[model samples]
Every structure is written in structure tokens, then in C-alpha cells.
Target: MRHGPATRRGRPAVSGRIVLRLDRMMVERGRSLGWLARQVGITDANLSKIKNNHVSAIRFSTLAAICEALDCQPGDVLVYEADDGDDGTGPRP
Candidate 1:
């Protein structure tokens, strides 16, 4: 029997992608990157990475901080896209 791709722990790989809308939320809230970083208790450079979706992972505490600062829910910032055979590098509509 053949097995599907496994993660480091041997569990089957999970598909789909998480898209960060940090920039959008920031604009909607009219808050600058530096201000958000300070409110979230993180560095401006680190926040920029998240805003640009350059990071592979994020901590729950950080997520909570962002949500609190932006007055939004987790779903508002982190959007999950199903794996539909299209490359995720394209800009969102």
C-alpha cells in the first residue's frame, strides 16, 4: 500500500493556504505600521513580515494582540484558501 505525503510527525500533509490581510485591516483602521507594531508589542520589521505574508507561522498570542489592536476577529485577518491548483502568489481580488 502506498501512503500519502507525511509531515515530520508522520501525519498526512494538510493542504490549503492561509492568506494574511494585515495590510487591509491596517488601512481600514487607519493605523500606521509603526503604531500597530507598538500596540501589538512587536517590532516594526516583524509586523511588516506578517503584513506582507512573508512568515510561515504566527503565534496565538501575537494573533490575539493584533486582533485586539485592530478591533477585529481572527477570521478578519487570516483567510484560508482551498487548494484549487492555482498558485497563491497572485494578488487577491
Candidate 2:
């Protein structure tokens, strides 16, 4: 079967990286994880994972909720940092 490009470790390689700034936003907003969790209608554990960048993906609904609760834009929470090796060529090998 055909498979996607992967790294030496056999994990899929991505061109750019998304950095989560949720923890920073939370601090700036002076909101606790539990408080934000309640406002976002999500469990603290899940929110914590997002804050710690331990999650691979986040639902739009959840992102919207977080933005709403934090009173900030999505850009304020997620920042994209392009991989130095990815010069718009293709996936890294």
C-alpha cells in the first residue's frame, strides 16, 4: 500500500509546525485552566493537553470556544512556525 512521506523514525513528516500559545494567552487573560475549561465547556485535562501542545489536532468547535472564552483571536492562540528545512519543496524525508 502507498503511504505518506515519513521521517527516519517512521513518523509522518510535516512541513510546518503549529505552536500553541494557549498557556501564554491564559496567563495574559489571568484565567486558570479549570476556569477556562468550564468556560470552554471542556474538561480541564483536555484543555491542559492543548495548552501543553500535547494534542495533535483540535476541533474547530473547541477552538472557537477557546477563542470565545479567552476573548482573543485564533492567531493569538496558535502560531505557525515553518520548518527550516522545508523551502516550499515538499515533505521532509
Candidate 3:
């Protein structure tokens, strides 16, 4: 359970968190948003939510589709960012 922001990464007392790197990968692949959405079988708007980091969850199937379309591994798309409270270690993107 979350007591407050202390256990969260919203504002103050930030901590490690998962991040999505779909935007950069898409750019490098020269793929358009609409094209990717079509390839992944998701709506452009929904994919936009994921791109902007507004969504909370994504299906493994969707992730696989994205990876296949981009020819990248999951690590190349998702990232883990650790705040100062962590062991001062951060996961590479």
C-alpha cells in the first residue's frame, strides 16, 4: 500500500520508476505513429497515451508487437529510472 508521495514518484520524495522509450525508438526506425498503431493493432490515440507516458499498463502482446515492428528488444523500449533514494544505481537505457 502507498502511504503518500513518499512511496510514490509523483512530486516530492521521488523514487525509482519504469519508463517507456517508444518515442526515440520510433524516431530511429523512421516509423510514423499511425503506422506503428496499425502494426500493433492499437488505436493511434491509445498508442499516443503510451508514448506520452500517461498510461499505467501495457499488455505483453502489445509489447511484443512493438518490439517486432521496431526490431528491438524489450530493454530498448522500457527503462527503469532510480532516484537518489535508491542505491545510487540507475539502469541503462
* Highest lDDT model number: 1
Against the true structure, candidate 3 reaches a TM-score of: 0.74
Whole-model lDDT for model 1 versus the true structure? Answer: 0.91
Q: List candidate 1 stretches off by more than 4 Å.
A: 1-4, 85-93
Flag regions of model 3 displaced more than 4 Å. 1-14, 85-93
lDDT of 3 by residue, 1-93 (tens): 555666345556646777888999999999999999999999999999999889888899999999999999998988876764443335545
Over all chains combined, what TM-score does candidate 2 have? 0.74
Which residue pairs of candidate 1 clash? none
- Total clashing residue pairs per candidate? 0, 0, 0
The lDDT, on a scale of 0 to 1, for candidate 2 is 0.88
Q: lDDT by residue for model 1 over 1-93, one digit each (tens)?
A: 438888998788879889898899999999999999999999999999999999999999999999999999998899876689544545779
What is the descending lDDT order? 1, 2, 3
TM-score of 1: 0.79
lDDT of 2 by residue, 1-93 (tens): 438889998888877988788998999999999999999998999999999999999999999999999899998888876777333335556
lDDT of each: 0.91, 0.88, 0.86
